[model samples]
Target chain A: MAKQERAIRTRRAILEAAGAVFDEHGYMSTTIAMVLERAEVTKGALYFHFASKEALARAVLDEQVPFGAVPPQPCKLQEIVDMTFVVGQRLLYNSLLRGSVRLAVDQETPSGIDHGAPFRQWAQALTRLLELARDRGELLPTVKPSETVELLVGSFTGIQLMSRALTDRADLADRLAVMWAHILPSIAVPGLLPGLDARADRGARVLASLEERAAS
Target chain B: MAKQERAIRTRRAILEAAGAVFDEHGYMSTTIAMVLERAEVTKGALYFHFASKEALARAVLDEQVPFGAVPPQPCKLQEIVDMTFVVGQRLLYNSLLRGSVRLAVDQETPSGIDHGAPFRQWAQALTRLLELARDRGELLPTVKPSETVELLVGSFTGIQLMSRALTDRADLADRLAVMWAHILPSIAVPGLLPGLDARADRGARVLASLEERAAS
Candidate 1:
């Protein structure tokens, strides 16, 4: 195998290992040796990819937003709904996303790390989509993109935390469904509510659709 | 002061100092000596009341809800709104409340602590009030007390965290106002929306009214 390919695989493995460790022990309690043991890599290999535990945590915290296409819908609201469910579903299986979320909301972060960046990023992403929905005349007249985005992002943060605390996020998709049901009334036009596919199984369906798209 | 009175005041002082320290450094990084220095009490005095740092943190985490009464409003929905805002406003001023909130949501808690207790307590508190609102016909016909309570508590959790991250909670009351405005349209009957005192200054007013009632 080419060295570049091998190096890329090793880096991914390290990040994956680091994410799980951070999620379990948090930043302050997590040690470099624990990450190295998990990754099954020597200290040299770990150092080559990252400088310290803080750097590793920084890298992990940056992976909350995964890059995969959710099949778009005619209604921008549907698209935003899919985006949130997809994330909700991903959090159930993805260590990197889980680690990032834990770090983002965790009271403790390593010095110099911008722990709040993910919240701001989620806010921006939701804002863009909400603005699109507004332009397409899908939103209610009282809908403010900025205010709703803050609520959406913040509520998502809190909803997921509650689900995790109560049920270990096994009900995250359902919780997201409940959130959308409560919020969509104030957000989307009354005409659009019945058609929006906000449901507990949305994340599973969205993921399956993505797989089908990839296979096709 | 009498011996019992002096002891009670000292205990309050130690808890207060420990709360601020925990708020600043989080659970793991906080040291007993740091709390002792802040409380301005001797190590022996501190130990006489609290056995360990975990014990001290547990004590602080128990104080998120302060024992002040918001004047009774005719609408139960109005009461819930005032409750959230009052906590929001207090979060900006009270060290014990602030520390409890931080510890409640912190990633790195000390060994053998129940960090999730506060979330459950908040959920139960809101659920009861929401149930009352439903019984009195203040809520919309379609409102589900169970579902709405989860969203309300969860959203408040996320909203305050967001406000704190974005503005150090300086705008928390206004954010709570925004939250209620959006949520009320769905939960409360249309007739009640026009009369609900869900505003930024609701907390200040509720607190001041409590003061006036005490004076009278």
Candidate 2:
């Protein structure tokens, strides 16, 4: 058990190190040596966890798939809004998520890695949520789940990218709030408009509640 | 006069070749030699036109700034929509714009190059247009031009990027139309909604008319 725990820790260290390097230098410029140097792990140990730089990037990409921070809400539309807001907050401080975004968008990444997988997964997850919202009569009759999912995903990506470029992602949550404000009125049922809270500070509130629940 | 014309032609050829190479290989990996080979120009001639690879990227970035295709509309909001649609059409075939976008977003770009200039210019231009819309009483009283410009620029970027990733940008105009459909209601005054055309075919129509005017 002790040996197994040590191995797990080493693997995590390597992943974190690789994510930092990939975040700073991007996929094409990141090297195995940099990860090893940053991780303070032996080459053998690093190789044991990830075979190549592509594997490291795949791991970072995978980390973005299971975004488990968004707690459930009574309002499905609000839940979707919460999910994006929490993600924007996470992106502000989370190295792995930041690196995953970089890898996903970087045009120089080699074709062998499936960079599109994360985006497709995000779309699927959001589509499923929208379907649930529709079933609950939360969405307007004119709203199509698939189309809304595409817009949400694409617009979220652009908001984050622009925020990163202009403010180093300091205002990602605010930008996402603006995005949802502009989009929700068109997609949500008119009745839901008065109840939805798409404020820039919503993520911080949700995150605080999540941490509180975890502590309890 | 003949020599000056030849110089201008050589400069244009070099810009085109560099744009193509940058679009394919991105900024960090692209080499001056590849651009020279593609342009079929001597090293001296290429240097005479562009001092460095960064200079070439800046030139491509500069090409994206002069977006003058949208004809005047009584409604300034519709004119803003038309500008994006025309740009979508241009992006469909314009290597310079495509390359400029890649360079502007790529994380590996060196610090010496001003990657954010194009985006800032775009935001400034859009802000000016939105101001016009506000002045003309086409925008809702609640809408702020600066914030709206940021959202428009960010969302348009996301829509274009998502189209590129998913469909190789084949459906960019369609996506832009969808974007406007969702956004216009939030920002434009209710009266203007009936007259605005946010159809996917608008780009094709705008492009056709531009070509016709140019030929005449």
Candidate 3:
């Protein structure tokens, strides 16, 4: 059991180190040697976990799409909004997610890496939630679920990219708040629009909730 | 005059070849030799115009922001919509524009090249037009020009990226049509919303008009 726990910890460390390198240098410029030096793992251990740099990047890319920690909101639209904020906040500190975004957005990988998976996954997640919101009458009557979700996903992607470029995402939550404010007028039902929590630190509350849940 | 024209033609050919290569291989993977071979120019001739691959890419990046070919419309919002479609059409066939977009969005640059310029230029252009839109009383009272323009530019950037990834951007105009449909109702007064020409072939007409004007 001790050995198994050690192996898991090593894997986590490697991923963290790889994520930092990949996020910083992007895919082609990053080397396994850098990851190893940062991770402080033996070459054999690194090889045991990942076959190639491509494989390692693909693994990091996969690690980012899961935002399981944000507690569910009563409104499906709020859940979607919370997910973007938590993600925006997380991108400020989470190397894994940051690397995943770099890979997803700007990195030109070899043909083997699936760049579209994250986009499709985000679309699917948002589409499912949008449909739920639609059914609950939380959406404006004219809000087409698929179209609205695409705008949200695409806008959020570019907003974060611009925020990252301009301010290192120090203003990501504020930018997201502005984004929700502009979009919600066209999306959420009139009553729900006033109640939507899209403040700058909403992500902090969500993360605190996650910590509380874990502690309990 | 003959010597000057020949030099101009050589520069155009080199830029085109470089743009195609950079768009396909991205910045880091692109080599000077590849550009020389594709441009069919001697290495000395290539270097005479562009000092390095980075210089060549920066030139391609600069070439993309010119939407001057798009004729202006009386309605500032219509002008913005028309410009996006024309750009969408141009991107399908223009290597320089495509390379510009690739450089602007992806690729690991050596920090000498400015990736944020295009985003800033786009934001500024759209902001100017949106304010004009407001002056004409064409916009909804709630539309905040800067916020709305940011959402538009960012959404357009990500929408084009997603379209390129999913369908090689064959459906870019259609995707953009849907985008304007989702956004205009929120931005434009009700009367202007129905008259917005966001069809896929709108770009073709704009191009055809440019051709006619040039011929005349």
Candidate 4:
């Protein structure tokens, strides 16, 4: 058990280091040696966890879909909104998410690896949430869950890309709020539109609450 | 006059060739030799027109902000919608626009050139149109032109990206139509919404009409 724990920690250190390097230099330019230097692990230890740079990139991409600790709200749409805020907060500080996004968008990455997996997973998760919202009559009858999922995912990617370019993603939460404000009114049932909290501060609040929960 | 005409033709040929090469290889991987070979122009001639690959990229970026021939519409918001459609149609065939977009997003490009210029110009153009929409009373009272400009540009970029990744942009017009549909209700005055035409076929029609007008 102790050996396994040590192995897990070592793997995490390597992944984090890889994420930082990938975020800085992009997937095509990032070298395993850089990751090793940052991770401070032996070549043998690094090889033990990841066989190649592609493997490391894949691992980084896999880590982007985080499992948030936020408890479910009565309104599944609120949960959906909260998910974006929480992810936006993480994206602002988490090298893993940032690296994954860069790798996913970078056209130079080897085509063999399925970089689309992370985007597909995000769309699927949102689809599931929207399904729940539909069941609860949160969505308007005209709103299609699949289409909404695509719009939300695509819009979020664009907003984040522009935010990254404009402000290094410092204003991601605010931009996402604007996106939600524009989108939610069209899809949400009239009664529910008034209650959805699509505010920039929600991200910071959600991050704080999650940290508090973790501490408790 | 003939020498000036030949020079104009040569410059255009070089630009087109460079755009095609950039579109295929991206800015970092593209070379002056590739463009020279494609353009069938002497190295001296290519250099005379564009000093470096960065200069070529800057030229490509500059060419992206086209002055549309579409005449004014009664509804400024409709004009804004029409602009996206016309651009989408152009993107379907224009290598210059494609290369410019790719270069703008590429992180490896030299930092001296303003990569943000195209996005900023697009936002400014949209801002101007929204301002006109406000004056025409086509916009909702709550719709701020600047904010709407950011949202529209960001959302259009995202939709185009997803369309490109998923379908090689075959469905770009349709996806854009979907985007405008979702956004228009929140920003367009309720009475104006019914008259707004946000259709997938609008791009081709707009392009065809523009060509006819030019020919006539």
Best by lDDT: 2
lDDT of 3 by residue, A121-199 (tens): 8888889888998999898888889877777777777788877765678877887887787777778888997788988
Can you tell me which runs of candidate 2 are displaced by over 4 Å?
A1-8
Residue B10 deviation, candidate 4, in Å? Answer: 2.3
| Residue lDDT tens for model 4, A117-155 | 777788888899899999999988988898888888778
Q: Provide the overall lDDT of each model, using Cα atoms, as 2-decimal numbers.
A: 0.84, 0.86, 0.83, 0.83
Provide all candidates' interface root-mean-square deviations: 1.3, 1.0, 1.9, 1.3
Task: Quote each prediction's TM-score.
Answer: 0.92, 0.94, 0.92, 0.94
Selected candidate, larger DockQ, 1 vs 4: 1
Query: What does candidate 4's lDDT look like per residue over B1-216, in tens digits?
Result: 699899999999999998888888877778999999999999999998999988998888777767333567899989988998888888888887887777776665566777778888889877988899899888889898998888887787777777776677898888888888889999999999889888998888987877898899
Clashing residue pairs for model 2: none
Model 1 CA deviation exceeding 4 Å by range: A1-4, A42-44, A67-69, B42-45, B67-69, B212-216
Model 2 chain B weakest lDDT span, ten residues long:
B62-71
DockQ (CA atoms), all models:
0.68, 0.75, 0.54, 0.64
Candidate 1: TM-score?
A: 0.92
Clashing pairs in 3: none
Which CAPRI quality tier does the interface of model 1 achieve? medium
TM-score of chain B of each: 0.91, 0.94, 0.91, 0.95
Provide the TM-score of chain A alone for each candidate, in the order shown: 0.93, 0.94, 0.92, 0.96
List residue ranges in candidate 3 displaced over 4 A. A1-3, A212-216
